[model samples]
Target: MTTTDMLTGALAAAARGWHVFPLLPSTKRPARPNHRERDCTGTDPRCRAGHTGWDARATTDQTRIRRAWSSNNPSYGIGIACGPSGLVVVDLDTHKPGTEIPEPWNRFGIRTGEDVLDHLAGARGGTITPTYTVRTPSGGTHLYYTAPEGVRYGNTAGTIGWLVDTRAHGGYVVAPPTTIGSSSYVVTDDRPAAPLPLFLLDLLKPQRHTTSAAAPKRFDARTDRVPAYVASAIKGEVAKVTSAGAKQHNHRLLCAAIALGQLVAGGVLDERTAYDALTDAARVLMARGCDCTPIEVDRTIRSGFHIGSRNPRTPGTTRDNSRKAA
Candidate 1:
C-alpha cells in the first residue's frame, strides 16, 4: 500500500477508538524505537525521565497520529495495540514447513490454525462467531474479539491449541493494508468485533505463579481429593505471598488466596484448609512490620477467594505442553 493508504488506515482505526501506531516502512516491526533504562543517556525527550516503549507511545488522538505517521517516515504501516483497543485478537496461524499437528487435533485432520480453533470451538459446543477478521499475507487469519469487561489477557503461544495464539495485553497486530513485500494483510470480514466467548476467556485466564509454579498440579479425585501436588502449589503460592515486597504484600496475598480458592471450588482442596493456610501465610507480612492490619489482610484474602470461587478452574486443564508449537 502507498503512504496515503497507510495513513488513512491508521486514522480509520483510531476513529474506531482503537489506539494505532506506525509500523516500520515495508515491515511489520514498529517504526518507533523502544528505549531501555540502563542504556539511557537522558538526551532524548521521550526517554528524558525514563524508558518509553512503542506500546506506551501508541495513540488515537488525531493530532498526534498525524504527526507520528507523517514525520520522517510517512510510508509506515498501521498497527493496533490490542489491549488499549479492548481487543483479544486470536491469531489463526498457517502451519509453516517443518511442523506437524499433534494428537487429538492431528487425529481430526486439523491442518491450519483456523482448523485448530474450529475444532476447539466445536469441542466446547460452540462455533466461531462472525467478527472482524483480517487475512494475513501468509494465508493466516486474525480474528478480532473484544476482551471481556475489566479483564486483561496476555499474549499466548500455542497454548489454547496447536498453531493457535492470541494477542492482547503487551501485544500488537499489523492492521489491514499493511503489506509485507507484495502481499498485504486484508480485512476479509468487515463485521464489528464480537465479545470474546466466555469459554474462550476461561482458557486465557492467567495464573499468578507463571514463574514460581510452572504448571497446575493434577490429581484424581477418585483416589484423593487433595493430593501432595496440590500441597506443593499451596506452599509455593504462600511463599510468594509472605516473601513479597513491601508494596506487593497485599496483592500477592490476595492472588495466592484466589488461586487456592479455585481449587476449593473445583473440589480439589477444602475451603477451610485453603483459608487457614493463606491466613497463616499473611502473618509473615505482619511480622515484617508492614502497615497492613489483620482485618485488611483478612478482607483482601476473602474477597480474592470469593472472586476465584466464582470461576472454578479444574486442576490439570493446562496439560499437553508437548503439543505446543505444533
Candidate 2:
C-alpha cells in the first residue's frame, strides 16, 4: 500500500481511541531509536531521548500521529500500544516450528484458533461472542478484546500453550492495512472490541497467591549469611515438591534445584550441603510415589548449580568467588 493509505489507516485507528505509533516500514520494530549515543538509556522516562521507543511515541493525538507518519518515512507501518488503547490481543500464532509443537497433532487433535474459540464458547454456554478480529499477514489471527478495568495485563509469550501469545500492557501490535512482504493485516470482524469474557479473564488474571503449591522465590542475597527469606523460600519449594502431583513433580524439583543453586552461589549454602539437601528433598517425593529417577534429579541440580555459579547472586561480583573468600 501507499504512504497515504498507511497514514489514513493510522488516523482511523486513532479515531477508535487506539494510541498509534509509527513502526519501521514492513517491520514490527519501532521507527525511533530507543537510545541515542550520548543519552541515558535507564528506565527513567524523563531522561529518555526523543521518540526512543514505541510506548513513548504512541499517542492518539491527530497532530502527533500525522507528524510521526508524514516524516521522511511515510511508508512506515502503524503500531497500536495495547495498554493505552485498552486492548488485550490474543495472538493465535500458526508459525511455530514443528519441533516446538507441545503435543503430537497426529496422535491428539490439532489445536487451532477455532478450537480455542470453541472451548471458550463451550465454557460460556455454546455462544462464541463476536469481537473485533484482525487477520495477520501470516495465517494467524489477532483477537482483540477490551481489557479488564483497572488491571494492566502484560505481554505473555507462550504462556498460554504453544502457538499462542498475548499483547497487552507494555506491548505494541501492528495495525491493520500494514503489509509485510506479500501479505497484509486486515480486519476480519469490523465490530468494536468487546469486553474480555470472564473465563478468559480468569485465565489472564495474574496468579498472586500460592494455590496448589508454594510459589518459587526469586534469589536476592546481599548479606553474607543466607537471609531468613531465602531459607523460607527453599522450605516452600520443598513443600511444593512433597505435595506436587505426578505431572508437576519434575518441574517442582527443577525449581527447588535452581533455588538451592542460587543459595550455594551466594555463599549461603555450601556445595555439598546444597547437593545433599536437594537429594533429600527429591527423596521425599520419591517416597511419596513420584516417578522421577535419581539420575534426572542429579542432572537437574548439577546443571542449575553450574549456571548459578557462573552468575552469582552478588551484583558486580566476578564468576570466581575466591576473592570474597580471601
- Number of the top candidate by lDDT? 1
Stretches > 4 Å off in candidate 2: 34-52, 95-100, 104-106, 120-128, 206-326
lDDT of 2 by residue, 185-274 (tens): 999988777666433565678542111222323333333534665556566766776677778776766666555555555544545545
Taken over the whole model, the C-alpha lDDT of each candidate is 0.73, 0.66
lDDT of 1 by residue, 1-326 (tens): 77778878889889878999888877888876644657777677777777776787889999888887674566888889998999999999887878766898768877899888766654543335557889998899999988868887899999999889999999999998888899999989786676675347547884321111122232223325358778777777888887899798877887776677666545556555566567667766666677776667656765565555544656665422221211
Candidate 1 segments exceeding 4 Å error: 34-38, 206-326
Q: Which ten residues in a row are the worst by lDDT in model 2? A: 208-217
TM-scores of all candidate predictions against the true structure: 0.61, 0.56
Superposition error at 132 for model 2 (Å):
0.9
Relative to the unseen true structure, what is the C-alpha lDDT of residue 234 in candidate 1, on a scale of 0 to 100?
Answer: 77
